[model samples]
Target: MSAELDLSPEVPEPTLLESLLYNGFFLGAIVQLLCILAVIKPTSNWYEQV
Candidate 1:
C-alpha cells in the first residue's frame, strides 16, 4: 500500500553545532597539513617568505 511505502526509514539531521564541528575539524586538518608541508618544503617561494 502507499502508506507502507511511505514508511521507509528516515535519517536524523545533525544539530547545528555537530555539523559545524564536523566541518571545522576537516578545515583545521587541512590547515595543519598545509603548515606541515610549508615547513617541509621551504624552498618554494609560497612558503619561504612567510
Candidate 2:
C-alpha cells in the first residue's frame, strides 16, 4: 500500500540519492514550516534579492 496522492511512476529501482532527495524535500519542508511558526525564520529584510 502507498499514499493515495503519489502520482510518480513506479520505477523498477531507484538510486539511494534519489530516494534521499525525495524524502529530504519533505523533511526540509517540515523543518522550514516549524521555523516559520516559531518566528525564527530569516526575514526578507535580511536579503534584498530574496
What would the per-residue lDDT of candidate 2 be over residues 1-50, giving only the tens digit for each residue? 57678789886877999899999999999999988876975556757666
Q: 1-50, model 1: which lDDT tens digit per residue?
A: 45555666788999999999999999999999999998988755766677
Model 1: CA > 4 A from native: 1-9, 44-50
lDDT of 2 at 39: 95
**lDDT of the candidates, in the order given:** 0.88, 0.85
**Which residue pairs in model 2 clash with each other?**
none
* C-alpha positional error of residue 8 in candidate 1 after TM-score superposition, expressed in Å: 5.2
Q: After superposition, how far is residue 9 of candidate 2 from its true place, in Å?
A: 8.2
Clash tally for model 2: 0
> In model 1, where is the ten-residue run with the lowest total lDDT?
1-10
Q: Clashing pairs in model 1?
A: none
